[model samples]
Target chain A: MSTSRELTRCKTFIPGFDLISNGGLPAGRTTLVSGGPGSAKTILAAQFLAEGIRNASQPGCFVTFEEQPADIRRNLASFGWNIEKWEDENKWIFVDGSLHPKDEPVMVGDYDLGGLMARVNHAVRTINAQRVSLDSIGAMLVQFGMPVVIRRELYRVAWQLREMDVTSIITAEHTGQAEAPVEEYVADNVIILRNTLEEEKRRRTLEILKFRGASHLKGEFPFTISEDSGIILLPLSSIELRQKSSDKRITSGISELDAMCGGGFYRDSVVLVSGATGTGKTLTATQFLAALGEDERGLLFAFEESRDQLYRNALGWGVDFPSLEAAGRLRIVSEYPEVAAPEDHLLRIKKQIEDFQPTRTAVDSLSALERISTVRTFREFVLALTSYLKDKQIAGVFTSTTPSLLGGSTVTEAHISSVTDSIILLRYVEAFGEMRRGITVLKMRGSQHDRNIREYSIDSGGMHIGEPFRGISGILSGQFTHSTSSELQTLHRMFENDDEES
Target chain B: MCKDFLGNHVMLEIIDVLQRPDEAENEKILATPTLIRQSPGPARRLVGDLGEPDRLIQLLGLQDHIRPRQ
Candidate 1:
């Protein structure tokens, strides 16, 4: 029995088809690559041979029964492999198995793949081919009418190739049957490639259905075939790369804001600052940039404010934009929601992240993003942006403007709340005939935080957070009444009665 | 309905529901905007626009911790 610790060491390699047969086709075993028309069986087989030649410095052989050698060469040209050049260097071999008109026909009992097997053996021995790909076994099977004869010939060919000590990939055409071909049952591996339509979108997927003698991943893997890169497999769905924990924290620049966040926000955490207009959402975000000190780098993406106005307004908040820019720690980019797509914005931010490598990033207000696309698109954008920031392990702060300050209504900012690791709510609270600002920590995932609603104020010196309310009523409703007055009178009467009794 | 001051002594779960009432309330039974203070004592229910944290604090007789309004 395997313990948890021992089981953790097991790793599987996807051999471009059902799991690569334990240590990849037994180092000298025969495997089959079978698929229907346009199933990319040839491409898969060729890629296996090509990858070995390029990556492993191991020579390989490609025997084609369907397409001409020139056509295969042209098709794989985009992947930067020169098969013809490799053939000249005596490192790779390509064999054309198309029958000629002058070839003589023989009886079923006398017919054999003796010539084909000899050529394959010679190619492996002469070029030192470590890998070999037979484009399609279907053509060979078609030539033999009797199932028993065909099966016997295929078995003989597989054993001969194994004796040559080459990792062989035999290709077959799938006929949409519930059961695989007879050759597949005898082979060491079986892989299936297919296209599926989901929600009117066509997706190309690959699954390793079986790999004999090997424990393989059984789920379908999503991949894309580009004109330049051919097939590029994305990260598998099963693996999760966790973010490294750090002790560093980011300041909101505003002293009051920083205090509300338990001294400061954690490094690499996403913070959502949501408030109504004129409540200083952008100012709070700018304060965050200003508090980074002279050495720390900060990036600010303003979708609503222009470059000049942003600088001027930030200056009003006592932030030294000129000096920060001169020190090479602060970068500001102005974006327009109407003119650019979300992808364009993502690319621009990605470039900035690469160039500046800032420790902190702020999206000045998500309201602008709402104007550019549908809710679904906006959500996707937020997810992608958060994923990108998490990849860089940079602390990000996003400001969102709620439509109103009171009553139960969807705070336009609701869409992005889930993606943010923390939410800081700023709003106006009325008390004693005056409107005061209040701040509260709505949620802070994976960290402990103060939950009390504290009164906050902003003046020439910047923001300030005060103690919690003492003896008032209706704090969230922007109204506060003194309950102490009536209670004090009652206490005085009780004291007088106690004195009389004494 | 009851009110209190010094929300520090308030039930944490009640505070959570009060902060985001829209999400906590169930509309299936015509249960419009109900606030259930489920901690620090017996649970109490308050209906209507209980948006004013100060008033709720006062009605709950928790003014000792609350400071006098400026």
Candidate 2:
């Protein structure tokens, strides 16, 4: 209770959890984690102890008032926690408080829970444990059916755990549909786990409701469970925006496009190329990744096409994908967005980026993945990927397909415009009864870029940027406005200001 | 303590908690003074000081089991 010293924190070593918790749980304090059934509450509690044993060699004690210790051990073995071996090595202990049906005790007069406390204390001392988990105080209510006694005893247990100097998590069950829980005042630090269904998709999130006297990232962070790992949270807000700006330039592989982007794209920048299906958005991403340096590698995630189709398309564009991959420089992974959730897709994409350690990555057609995620989730996915690449000083190209074939702004571009360093728009321009293509650098950060809409055509060699499209207006909003004879002269005067005449 | 009430009908089994800690833990015995009516339909357990003989029988619902010593 001393306010003079800074509170210590205990890192759980759960992936992405420590970052969002601003280090970890408050040290030597009792944190009550409340969630509904099947919300992975038990898994999280066990992981707190398991990670302690695995990461730091710190022993732990589990005081369960519901499920049997054997059941917990068996259920959590998929997480690679060998509870039986830990018990044999004196690194883990379980104070089984499970109310065996045959051994159910009757409460005629009065009781104190001294026996349970004694067992818990004995187990803690047995291993010199630094962490402890009390699985669900709600079950104890069923056993005793006395709310007053349980509340008093729970407060006492919290104090006792503090005295023992162990970081602990006491899990409790709450109805998921309700917006409030009665146990908000039960503990100083509280975390809530929610598994909610939105738009027929299950989204699991972990929210730190309050951390008394400590700093933590507020709001819910999306999380996913994998077979190898129990629960992995995507701490989007934890990603710092203070990425080092790199002045170094890399080519977009298209010579005219590079000249238009003020020499070239920044080395650590994320360029979002947005266009319709036939406007060659994928071609722009492909060219960007193909411009990797001699020794540098490239990673491409193709969500719209298969491996052979991508290779064939690249070969048609005069870029040999098979030989580049043979040289150990290029790696391509293609998958449908419906195969996994947005969190899982991001995790897998990140895994590839880490494993390959590429200098550049191109996700061909980010719009393909957008269909599987909600607007908010898609924004987070793009932000996470963009920041991840920028932090590593890796250039990225994310292609997004607009909903319409003509000049139109895509939803993906609108959501991720601020996150990307540069935005390139490719549109279908219907000029003089002929459907033509045009490209323009819409926005660029910290660099002067070509602002005029220039006509471009996709050939066997790739996108070739030609002369600027004059006398055209409203090409961005999926409309064409022809200029009058007098207005065309004024447009010519504006082009004369560009100093392009030889 | 309740020997007078169930003189002939009761089969008294005394259990020392310190010596038989396993049995105490098995029964989830947290308190010292405890009484259990094992047989005669559904079993029942009454813990703590029984206070009086009538209250003990009333609490345990063993009014029929209570009889005078032969």
Candidate 3:
């Protein structure tokens, strides 16, 4: 086990996939890339070859069995990998194994791929390549008719590649089987890529099936392919639940509310401010940003509102967001939640956090994120995001809008509250014949908090935490009942009588 | 309803009030199981069920509503 831990890993340039694999495609071994049509199989194989040639200065041989070399070059140019340049510089070799009309006429009844192997071997020796890719081994398998013949030929190729001692990737189509019959027992490692519709939007996910003599993160990680970033994998399984705990606390901008929270929220803690619509959720989040020190920076991800709209709203609450932005103490990123996958959202937030390195972060409302994906995906996104922030030791404040005006609902109730270190519930309490907003510290993990449901109001001064609702009951239930004056007087008289008798 | 009035009257009434849309909005009858008495010196409104008879009587001065059990 320890030896495997210390085993040398060939890091792939394909971002998060390598991280999840514990290391990239075990060194000097074969990895099978299985996926359906248009599932990024060819792109991954090309990236592996390109990554090797460019980063490691390790020349590679891309043996294409489907697309012609020229066509491959055309496709790879979009990824900014100049295949022609590498080929001309003698740093890379392209072995076109694609079946042509000439090969069709030359074929006989009894045949062997000895000629193909010779061509690949000559190319590998020419460049002294360190990596090799056999894209769409399925195409070659189809060329060989019988299953027994295909398996025998594949084993021979696998053996030859093993003898060559260069890391290799063989791409194949997933034929609805655990181990696709052809390359079943051949490859040292197997990775399956899936492209399926999730709520009418395309969602791509990849999973590692088997890693010989190595342990890897075990789960299907979501990925996306873009023009710029070829294949971006969001590996949730690789994320360790090891966040450093801090004794320090950060203020929520509202001093009284901070006081109620027993000296504010803990630094590196995830605090959720959940309430109904139009109940000052965003305003409270702005106050959190305002509370940052002069040198400290805050990053706000506004999903429900635009950056300009947030600025206007914060200005109304006297947050001075414009001044903060001008002073370089704040960054507000506004984007629609439905525009991308939940995994993309995680990666985008991570990218922002890395670039901005903010002391504080606030997602204006996580409720909108719930609308973009399934509940399971949303939960994973939230957990992954919060744990990541905690790892960075940044104070994160997320706002969620509850559906009900009284006491229930919001994303917090969707088990998001359990992951958060603190939960503050804001609700509308009817008092004095009008709707009045109230705030309460529902749960504060690892800290003492005032449990009283204090009436609060949003005004020009922002959210002000006033005294606890005195002589009233059922505030949380949305029922307002003030102590009856006559009853109070009777109680006072009774108390006086008892005092006089004593 | 009688069991709740005998049991945790205040809690039951609060829950009941929260469930109802109209009654919870009413400023006069804010809480549920609101027991109101008229023509008893002066009208009085009690927020919850009259769990404790003596306290309820003194609160609303409802002497007529109180019936002594044999």
Candidate 4:
């Protein structure tokens, strides 16, 4: 043991989960995992047991009360958890407590789960199991109609399992009752899994409400279940904020914009470029990636466009993406947001960043990710992703779409700009009868930045930042009016204090 | 009513075999909704609905002393 606190942990090998649970579950204690249907509670319990077998060489027993043993085995086989092989080796035991009755009515108070407990005990004793999981005590509760009797039998089962000195996980279904379930009171630890509909998209979260002997993170954490990785927990609070500031700087790939951002964006800093449609957000992000040196690496996560589309579009800007890839300096990852949750997308990006070791990263637009989740969850996801990148000392460039073509206000701006280190606003300015693009440095932390709203154009030559929009007012409000030189000087003098405050 | 009639007529033990699957398997009870007359001589098994009181009483050899449903 590395420290005195390490004595009580069982160390479940699920990734990103153990850190949030202080270390792992309290050793030799029962954990209650209660959730609704399709919440992946069973998968988590199964992963706990499988990880024990594969990593710690600790034998386990799975007392299945809901699914048949063979069916469970076959279902878990899709996850590559070979239950049969482990069972055949005597290192694992599977007890089937499924009620296989044809039509027999289970009378109340008559069925005490004695038969099921006997089988579980036998299996545990045979394997000398170190871990045991009763997959859902709810199945038995339905058989024994009385809640008091079910509670008593469940407590009895939990006590018996504890007496065997094995770490146990018992699953329960959320009955939609006002009061907490009996299993929550009986177990040493309780974790709830929730699968909810938010804006017509499914969001999954895991929350550890109680741990008997260990301190844990005190809020709900988002998680996802991949076919390959059983249950991936994204404990955002587990990541420590990187407080050390970096003095180094990286280019924005466009020279004029870099000059406006006070010698490019600070190294390992997050920069947000907010704009409406057709405002060159993607082009600006790709330019940032193109600015990386031949040795330094960059990764672009294009949420809206396909890889080929980004490549073809960048070619129009006289940027050769294939050459950068050949030189091993750039990688573009395009993923469809409609298929998975935001956590899944973040996990994939984390994996790619870890493997590629990119010095700089870019998410072309966060609005697409927002479409896949609720606004609150998307903000959390963005915060975690940006913090993780900063901890790795990787400069990040993220683009967000404003709802109005005219720069009024947007949800993305209100939520994302606070988390980012710098903000650059791009808007459409109607000077006369024609529309033109204008750019401004809204905020840059830890350094001085250009406060002027400049005119910009995007064509085959990419974004060319021209001179600041002189003798013009209300450029960002979409109602542009020409002003005299004296009026421009007076206007600048009036907003000088405001610029300093901003 | 059938249970009441059986109790009034015969001295027998009624056990819900589902409470003990091992015991049920030991008795070679393969299907459910099954009634096994364990002792009066040789064991006989009757399967399906026992909702019909007269048919159940007759099948269990209790026809000699049939009671009306009160």
Compared with the true structure, all predictions reach lDDT values of 0.66, 0.85, 0.77, 0.80
The DockQ score of candidate 3 comes to: 0.00
lDDT (Cα, 0-100) at A414 in candidate 2: 86
RMSD of 2: 3.9
Please state the CAPRI-style docking class of candidate 4: incorrect
Q: Report how far residue A284 has shifted in candidate 1, in Å.
A: 9.1
What does DockQ come to for candidate 2?
0.32
Write candidate 2's Cα lDDT for A1-502 as tens digits: 4544557899999999999998899999999999988899999999999999999999999988889998999998988889999999999988887777864665656656656666676678778999999998888888777777777778888899999999999999878764556676657999999988877787889999999988889999999887777889999867888899999999999999988999999999999998888788878877877787877899999998999999999988888899989998999999998999999998998889889999989998788898888888888988898999999999999998888888777788888899899999999998889999899999989999999999998899998999999787888886898888799888778899887763
Candidate 1, residues A345-411: lDDT per residue as tens digits?
Answer: 6656777899999988999877787777556546656776776787688889888876767412234
User: What are the interface RMSDs of all the models?
Assistant: 41.3, 3.4, 44.1, 8.8
Give the runs in model 2 whose Cα sits over 4 Å from its true position.
A1-5, A484-486, A491-502, B5-70
Candidate 1 B-chain TM-score: 0.43
User: What order do you get sorting by TM-score, best first?
Assistant: 2, 4, 3, 1
Model 1: how far residue A471 lies from native, Å: 13
- What lDDT score is found at residue A240 in candidate 3? 78
Candidate 1 chain A least-lDDT 10 residues:
A5-14
Q: What is the TM-score of chain A alone in each candidate?
A: 0.61, 0.94, 0.89, 0.89
Q: What lDDT tens digits, residue by residue, belong to model 3 across residues A98-186? A: 75543222111233444455556667777898888888777865654445555565566667877888888888888655556546456
Q: How far in Å is the alpha carbon of A336 misplaced in model 2?
A: 1.6
Select the stronger candidate by lDDT from 3 and 4.
Answer: 4
Selected candidate, larger TM-score, 1 vs 4? 4
lDDT at position A408, candidate 1: 22
Shift in Å, residue B37, candidate 4: 11
